[model samples]
Target: MANLPTLGQRFRRGWNAFLDKKAYENFNIIGGGYSGPNYRTILSTNTEQSIISPILNRAAVDISMIPLRHSRVDENNIYKGTIDSGLNNCLSLTANIDQTAYSFMVDVAMSLFDEGIIAVVPVDTSISILDSSSFEILSLRTGKIIQWYPRHVLVRLYNDNTGQREDLTLLKSSIAIVENPLYSVMNEPNSTLKRLVAKLNLLDAIDNQSGSGKLDLIMQVPYAIRSEQKRELAEKRLAALETQLKDSKYGVAYADAT
Candidate 1:
């Protein structure tokens, strides 16, 4: 007979499986409703963790305080002079018009920390989308991707002035995206911080639903459930109450009795 897998082998298999997982997918539902991916729940959870995880905020703030960079990190400066003037002007400002470069970088860091993904989208172009120089530039916006398509992506832009979210569909060629930064530490299903955020999300959900429950709802029936006839009446009343709750537009049930 073939021997069963040893304990070490079984442990290794389980660990590997855990490491391969992406997300626990806890964002789909919150407060008994579908929470679409504007990342509200995740952000709410991250905000709740500020006290416990102060370092996260501190690090984010420090990094965001740094000015935006025109060239790559530690990139050879030899090619800096060769860069286009229009591109240089464009680099002076962030792609996001709603935000200054400071806030743009901050939001980018915050979004990565909270949602694990972000995008820089080109919303307009000076001459053509392909033009690189000659004092030409398109506009750029920093935002998160809500949906992806074959040739285009649906992005949710942050509007600071109006404090309202705006979504745009932009071509794939002009978008720079970073997904799942520090995946193992920040985004993986079983990672410590990821698990912490998931747990925080669960707690935040519970907190939001704490007082918004059916506790205030009360059902009344005149008869007891002891006898067969009374049981039928009680069931009917309960069913009617359920139907009333379901049929109402705002979960309000109306009844009249003399």
Candidate 2:
């Protein structure tokens, strides 16, 4: 053990030692190119060997290399901007790095949601007690208003002129009203790419709304895209939150609450 180093020391040594390493050479694919194999390679030399590798751990250093693959060319096939755009949107998210207005807005919105800033509005109609003159009356109900308090207003519709009987069908319309304000904020053309920027900002604002106070029924915004990556990110975040809940010693963490 005279020469042996501790894990921490070894890790540091590996990181420092691997600072200069050549990773890729002869970066070419087989059976590629229009005329012949269009090959490219970093001819290994003192110059190539000087390239650096990233230290990952005490035992591992990270270096990236081009993969060898067969290439095909078809004359009839045409390459179009549409294909590029599609690839940029789906397969390559980096395409939108500069394109998206304020990239952090999505993260801000998601963080707000993760921090219990999200609110859910129940679409189903149910019985609600309305007090009029200290007397409860069944009335035709439309919806419960959701907004910032003190300034927020709630308007309920009743079935009869006397407001005695409650109508549940009208309650479904509540969801409709909840969404309008968000769109209105998005549509305001006071800023850059106003609508899209507003939509993204609105999401962040909505998520932060729950932090202000208690929320009964509120609107939930849609995600940018219901993709597998988004789902996996959500699942991982939820798992982390669950682990924190377990550590908190809070009795019976409710999965349904998330």
Candidate 1's C-alpha lDDT?
Answer: 0.61
Candidate 2 colliding pairs, count: 14
Off by over 4 Å in 2: 1-141, 144-153, 156-159, 162-177, 180-182, 185-187, 190-258
Q: Candidate 2, 246: how far from true, in Å?
A: 90
Error of 1 at 175 (Å): 1.1
Model 2 C-alpha lDDT versus the unseen true structure: 0.32
Give one digit per residue, the lDDT tens place, for model 2 in 63-144.
1111211233468654423333322232223212222212222322222222212221222123331212122111111233
lDDT of 1 by residue, 1-258 (tens): 999889998887755657755554453331233234232323535343553346656666787677544453335544343344444444556544445555555566766776777786555556655454332444555677899899878889754334456897866676688775574464334456556667888898888888565555566665456889887876777778779888888987755451
- RMSD (CA, Å), each prediction: 23.6, 36.8
